[model samples]
Target chain A: DAGITQSPRYKITETGRQVTLMCHQTWSHSYMFWYRQDLGHGLRLIYYSAAADITDKGEVPDGYVVSRSKTENFPLTLESATRSQTSVYFCASGLDRGRSYEQYFGPGTRLTVT
Target chain B: EDKVVQSPLSLVVHEGDTVTLNCSYEVTNFRSLLWYKQEKKAPTFLFMLTSSGIEKKSGRLSSILDKKELFSILNITATQTGDSAIYLCAIGANNLFFGTGTRLTVIP
Candidate 1:
């Protein structure tokens, strides 16, 4: 009920299908981020939101969409899933200004595109 | 382009051995460097280094940053099997840029 949590801990979807991974944080941190972890690529940031209604693209943003309608929620959507899109998705929250700029991560969602 | 690169992508060692993980980065508007330990699930934060030459220590783990060389190193002394995990390094600038990470395996 506290910290950050992700939904659909594991998912398997067909290519071209749409899938949405949910992330919710109780800390209500100003910054929320979506990242995908892939072998040989590590955790690549897909999108990040500075605050509610303010989002920006990160390193690997193509084929992925993210929205932060509320400070406590940041969801990532795969409009047309591809095999390449199959990976572990992680959501993190952090405060913008503080000595602790480190992010707190969610449990993560393992998605497989078949 | 902002990038974070970790060295010795994977390592294996016996318990009681010492290991040093390296992370190098090239980014604009440098901010802070962070370390994370990832097991089967999500990554857990370890340390965040912003100032150069100051070592951040926690138990047997320690890390230091060098902004001049654009690099950082994580040292673990007397490694144990429980320490086996993927250690990730991320650079914080406009956004956090993470390295591929070093998978450390401590054999008993």
Candidate 2:
């Protein structure tokens, strides 16, 4: 396919355990983002990468780490998972060209921490 | 802090009815506003608005952004069962700020 994809569509981890969600995009977009979708919180950006090796924190980045070693891959890691981290995580990609800033999302990974 | 707020957290309407979803934002260095339609999986892109007054349309769905008012509205006409989904509004600046989203249900 020629779109974004996430691995382990569904995941479950115990509290204090480490978990990582993988995201890959085939479009080679320069901007990749990680977001968590919760009940009351629609989608809060956890981290984003402008390009390979260039990452920045977003609205909600605590307890989470992200790396973009390659342009097609951006993975999110939870150092110590907590029950509060249980939510649907989405990965998106976009271009940082002119005035267009629209993003395309992946299927999303449902993570549960108990 | 930058923020995006959506109105009418949830809505229910008949199949043939029309609905409008609102999104207001308070973001610094606002670049653009985007809308997405989510069913059970990832949210699909709907529209991206940067300028004001100009309306963007696709099939039965349309949206307009008001840069001066710092808000946007998505409208769906002749809604169908497939129109039932969560409509998300996001603001683009340094990154993207998303609203809680509006859950719309179109009943037969």
Candidate 3:
């Protein structure tokens, strides 16, 4: 209740379909991020938001889209899911400036595109 | 491109053995390095190292950063079964760039 959480912990969908992953945090942090964890690539930033209504592309933002409509919610969307998009997705939140600016991750969503 | 690389990939050791996990990075605006222990789900923070040479320790776990060499090492002494988890290293320069992580197994 006091930390970050993700919805649809596990999902399966077909290619070309649209999928959305939801992330919520109770801390109301200023920064929210989305990352995909793969076997060889590790965790890569897909998108991040500095605050509500403000988002930017990360390392790998080609097929993924993200939006932060509120300080506590940041959602990631896959407009046209591909098989290569299958991976574990993580959401994290943190303050922009602090002694502990470390991001705290959510439970993660495992998405499989068939 | 910003990148983080971890060494060994995977490791197996006895409960009493000590282990060192390595992480190296190549990125601009060098800021801080962080370590996390991921078990089944989200990664939990362990340590954050922003300064070089100064080792940070907690209980039996310690880590040091080397800005000159662009690497960091995490050390765990007297390992336990509970210590068997994927150790993740991330470099934070406004945002985080994570390594693939080292899968560690501490056999009883």
Query: Candidate 1, which segments miss by more than 4 Å at Cα?
Result: A98-100
Model 2 steric clash pairs: none
Please provide, for model 2 over A1-114, each residue's C-alpha lDDT reduced to its tens digit, 9 standing for 90 to 100.
Answer: 899999999999999999999999999899999999998888999999999999999989999999999999999999999999999999999887553368889999999999
In candidate 3 chain A, where is summed lDDT lowest over 10 consecutive residues?
Answer: A94-103
Off by over 4 Å in 3: A98-101
TM per candidate comes to: 0.96, 0.96, 0.96
In model 2, the runs with Cα more than 4 Å from the true position are A97-100
Residue-wise C-alpha lDDT for candidate 2, range B1-108, written one tens digit per residue = 788999999999999999999999999989889999999999999998889999999999999999988899999999999999999998888877889999999999
lDDT by residue (A5-106, candidate 3, tens digit) is 999999999999999999999997898889999988888899988889999998899998887778999999999999999999999998866433498999
Q: DockQ rank, highest first?
A: 2, 1, 3
Chain A TM-scores, per candidate, are 0.96, 0.96, 0.96
Residue A38, candidate 1: alpha-carbon lDDT: 94
| Residue clash pairs of candidate 1 | none
